[model samples]
Target: MTLELQGIGVSRGIAIGRAHILFHNQPDVREYLIPAFSIEQEVERLLDAIEQAKQQLKSIRNHIPANAPADVTSFIDTHILMLNDSSLTKVPVDMIRQRRCNAEWALQLQRDALINVFNEMDDPYLRTRRDDVDHVVNRIHRILADQEVADHEIADGRLKGHIIIAEDLTPADTVLMQHQGIAAFVTEHGGATSHTTILARSLGIPAIVGVESVRRYVQDNEPLIIDGEAGIMIAGADESTLKEYQQRRIAFDEHISSLSRYKSQPTRTRDGKTITLLANAELPEDITTISNAGAQGIGLYRTEFLYMNRLAPPEEEEQLAAYRDVVEGMNNQPVTIRTFDLGADKTVDGGRHLTQTVVTNPALGLRAIRLCLTQPAMFRTQLRAILRASAYGKIKIMFPMISTMHELLQARNLLEQCKLELDKEGMEYDRQVEIGAMIEIPASAVCAEMFARHVDFLSIGTNDLIQYTLAIDRIDDTVNYLYDPLHPAVLRLIHMTLEAGRKFNVPVSMCGEMAGDPRYTRLLLAMGLEHFSMHPNALLEIKQIINETDLSLLPANTLSIMEVSDALEADMLLEQINAPIIIKICLSFGFLIRTDKRILII
Candidate 1:
């Protein structure tokens, strides 16, 4: 019997191979206990475990030669820093002493403190570092245990030559990914830049995610085909089906060879219009991927990730070093950094929520630009840091989730105050840094023209823009199906956003999931959108759409395209394309023939 699976495309490519299962399970605190003979023995146990962990990491870190690249060294340093950090080690050791609990129990108790911090941070970038902590804990767990047990070890004989599925995975688990390894990874949670995605991409594997019920659907050793590029799932395939893909698989390799030619070429449309191809990155490790993918700049540099893994906020000096690394790595290319957008949904030491107050709806709760305003001191610290880094490179600061004038005004005011303080210190700063607002909210979309006056440019975040505009929490399991970026309402706001931007003569760009999707790329380009920022993996496909786009007929296509009733029409329009397809066919031939136009996907 054949089976099919589907998932989001992270790094683009094609592969057809047998399943390679990677078992990733949470560390059982029960496993780390050592007989407590005395305080001396307990410390020795921990010290020994810590040492073993150091060696295992050093071995993995040294797998690549020393002269490989700076990024490789930094990746190893990340694990090293986490392993030696006092945040996880000190608190847990203190707990073991105070409570006289076993080391395993001590680890469990101390782990909560670290987990609490990660759960509270609203920044996705920072929130992602939770994986690093998990990595460290897992590393230590393996070191302290008597048996060399991990769910799946690549070097193990049983590990290679099978497809793997898990609830979730960490980077440490994925470190086992060797070249010509990791057939695929399917999990209940993750996006393109997820830990599993990174490992799979590095190993060039096909994967699917958010399958909703992957564990139930998949039987152990069930034959399956995971299509990474098309995001298709094909159950047992007939010989012809397999052969068709085989030819395409070979074509994919040839296609890859062709892309190398454009790796150094400027991204230009067939008409010779140039478009800046860039990457939306949060981690410093991501910067190299962007550069290697031949991206021109870093379009969205989410700063929250730096603060997520640790106990306290990063020091000013640490922040400076991070920014310098990113900017200097870009070699004068632009890096637009978005300030931290934290709220009740994302709590911190300085967070305004009543201590530990839990809110039901975090998306609508205080977050992004609003959180910064509530805590001006915290806000000023970030602003001051960005301005200080301005002298180092071409940095553009953008605020996320700005819904009203007051938020933008007060944020600007805080920025101005920081500028003065920097002035007094005789620090070199970008005297006039470009400021922008993410047009994610409905009110902001309609009022974008007014916003452009106060800001240098507008980058529409369609992911949240669609959600807030439609009053849908796309994350809500009940409404997840309603997350539509191609709905007419979404398009109009985009149209309005672009129109408003044009009126103000400010550059308008979209840095969202919608921008990266190939199907929507042409539709967006026809909607008068020129600037796009998306995942590093999406640049080539989106650019291909841009090159093949029939921009001439988009104005006429608008009426028919908008007439399609719903997302399915939009889906069909996207999935199929002719060499010189008319934009109008996409608009009219969609499945939205009968639905009401005003109803939103949410």
Candidate 2:
């Protein structure tokens, strides 16, 4: 009998083939003391394992095709650097000698310590780096434990034309699979924003993630079919099922190809209303994709990365260099840089310990602008760097998580101090740099008019706004289902912020997951949102929707959607108003649209 499974479909497409399982079990290392006489031998053994892991990473980096994409090579090179870095290799060796423990045990301890530091971080992108540390050390663990290191690339003649199944895949694993001619891949864990899924989309591979226990449910070599568009997986598929997916696979491919044509078109609604679509970025590597996606600007350049994965916070020069690279790349497009939003769960490496003792709930504790206001020195450092970089091109500064007028005043005061210092130092920066505030907190959203008077623009961070307004933790899967963006309370907050921006004549934008999603495109536009910032992958698709949409047809529909009390009812109203537009899109692209579920599969 066929066993069907559901997961979050991240990369869209379809795949049908035999299963190729990649077993990557964490090393089980129990702490035990070795004889003093064996201590030197253990240290040497640890060093040898480190050398072997370095060699393995070097080989993987070498295997990256000469003609492969720049990102693939960049990911492999990063792993090789980690293997050779003193922090990883040298630190573990020191632990082995000092603790008088086995090599596996020593490395395991170091991994935990490093992960602990990363876990306390507030940036989601930096938090995910803990997985990278795990993958690199797992390579050494395999060598130390005398376990076979499975081949990652498919060129070694293991399972050709097979769908890879794993508990989770790192960026390196995804890149290697692309080179291996793997048909598709399924993972038990990951999200749409994960680097693994991003790589899969870049490589144009079908992938499903967050399917718990998929690896254990299927035997090796079992025939499997993956519908990435629908997030469905069928094990031991029947002939009829296989035939249905084959047709879908073709249509999905054609639809994706058609989207590329929008790369050069302006994003304007059918009623001739121009829309500004910008890219939300975390890393410097993401900037190229932003331009490739034809974004008008970088809406949100998350600066938390400048404070992560290091012994201390990035120096002003270091931050300036990174910001400059993005500025030069955008070629006059506006780049809004948010201040280092540390505290909460995200802690800085070399910066001040703002939260010494763990707060029972860090989310409500010192974070974002609150932490920055309390620690003006740290805030000044970032402000100076951002001001210095602004001279290079169009740059704007945005403060995150501002909950009160006092916090905003304190932050602006320090920013002025940074500008004075820069002027004293004879540095060149744009004196007219635009300042903006992120209206995420309910308190701030309610008082947006007060904020608009002080800043040049307002960008609604809907992700946090919805989470806070609905009293749900977005990261907590249990309560995540209750996180509604369409709820009446959430809509009122958004509407209030936008209306305030309009009253003050300040540009209002949204830089959140909701802004990137096509499902809410018409709803947001009707609510008077003209600026949207999202992941680069969705830029073209959202633009396609914007270009075909007539803003004149949406206000009444949006009013009706907001008045509904039931969440499901609101969703149905949105689909009813939006479905015709989607259908037109599907017909234009010559693809079938299946609305059997929340996801519109083409």
Candidate 3:
């Protein structure tokens, strides 16, 4: 009997191949119990592992197709860097010596520390890199602990006459499979935003993650057809289904190819409304993604990176150089630069100590503009750098956390201080630079009208607002279930903020994960959201959604759902509406989706 499995649909495409397990996670040695001179020995071992990982990464790089996309190269290059970084190897090796533990044990400790860092990042792109970091270190730890290099890739490459099934895949491992012609990939863990999913999408391969116990169903060499797009898999000898799927696959490929032609064009709806799309980036290198996507601007340029992955704060000049490059890249496009949003969980190296002995929650802890307001020097320097760079192109400064009127005033004061200092020193600055505040805090959301009066614009940071309002840490896997985007509290806050922005005649944009979900596009538009900022990759797709949507009825549809007492019902209502037609239907009637799950006519 074939044991069918289910998993989250990540990448789209079709494939059929054999079961091949990439390398198992490296052994997890908690620590070493050795005699004297143990630290020195562990250091040497780490060095050896570094060299080995380098050689392995080099081999992988060499095998990648010359025509392989730039992102593919980045994945390999980043893995190599992770393998070589002293932070991962050196510090852990030192810890092993200090604690009299083995290299595996030391690595385990370091892995814990690295995870702690990933947990601190507020930026999504930067936060996602943590997953990459975890995967890399986990692999290294397992490899060293297990003392094995399974020739899985080599064996499977030759045995291409089979299907691919596994528990889950790291982005790097998935890329490795691609080089081997593994055909299709299925894993038990991953999401729509995972790196593996993104790679598969970019590479035009079929992949499914979160499918459970797939190995129990398929024999190692069974012929299969994986419907990655629709999230289905067929095992062996279904000639009719196979033929039908093949035709569907062919059509899908043709359609995607057709869409590729619009890769460089502005996304306009079939009805002729031009939409603005911007990319979310971390490093300067990501600017290429913006150019490739033809984004209207850099929707979110995370500045936390300038603070994270290092022992000291980035100097003003260093920041200026980085900011100027992005400015130059976008040329005329606007870049919304949010301030460094550090919370109690994210401590600056030797800069600040926790004032509160123990805060129940750090996510709602002193973070973002709150942290900056508390640490004026860092805040001032960042402001100066941004103002200096603003002279290069269209740039707007946005503060991340502004709950009280004082925070906004303090932030503006800092901005002014930076400008005054720059002026006194004869440094070029954008004197009339516009400023905005992220309405992430409940206090700010409730008083958005007051906030609107103080800033040029408002951007709802749904990621934080949802977490704060529901008191759920979205990052904590254990309690993430409690985080609900459809919570009445969340809807009320968003609506109130958007309403405030509209009333004050200031633009309101959403720069949160919710903005990226197509399912919520109609709901958000219906909420009276005039602007949407999301990951640049979604610009065209979102534009497609926007073009097809009639803004007039979305509010009513949203209100209609809001009238419902059950969150499930609201979600079900949203799911029932198709993406392309939801807008047309809304515009046909002046309806809005409300917080109470009931329709309200405009």
**Candidate 2, 1-602: lDDT as tens digits:** 88999887778778888998988866687888878899889888877887887786676677777655456666666677667766676777788778888888888888898778666654454566677778788878888888776676435756557899999897777776777788899998776656677678777788998888988898889999988867888997788777767766776677678889999998899999998999998778777778888999999999876775456777888999999999999999999999987775564553235467766666688888888887777778789989999999999999999888888888888888998999999999999999899999899999999999999999999888887888876544456568788898888899899999999899999998899877888888888899999988889989888998998776465766667889878878878778868778766666556553554655
User: What is the Cα-based lDDT of residue 95 in candidate 1?
Assistant: 66
lDDT of 1 by residue, 1-602 (tens): 66666555454454555554445444567624444567556756776787777777776666654434334455556777767767656766776666666666676566666667665544344455566666677667656556555646435556454556676665545555543255666666665544556555554566666666677677677655655665665657889667655655565556555556567666666666667777888778777678877787877888876654355666677787888788888988989999986666553433234235576566667788887887676778788888888889999999999889988998998899989998999989898799999999899998888898999989999877887878765534466567777677888888999998888899888998788776577667666787889877667656665665556634454435655666777655543432243332224333111111221111
Q: What is the alpha-carbon lDDT of model 3 when measured against the actual structure?
A: 0.70
Mark the 10 consecutive residues where model 1 has the least summed lDDT.
Answer: 593-602
Clashes of 1: 28
The TM-score, computed over Cα atoms with residue i paired to residue i, of candidate 1 is 0.84
Best by TM-score: 2
Q: Which model scores highest in lDDT?
A: 2
TM-score against truth, every candidate: 0.84, 0.92, 0.83
Better of 1 and 2 by TM-score: 2
| Clash pairs (backbone) in predicted model 2 | 120-345, 121-345, 121-346, 121-347, 122-346, 312-350
- Superposed by TM-score, candidate 3 places the C-alpha of residue 584 at a distance from the truth, in angstroms, of 11
Give the distance in Å from residue 580's predicted Cα in candidate 1 to where it truly belongs.
3.5
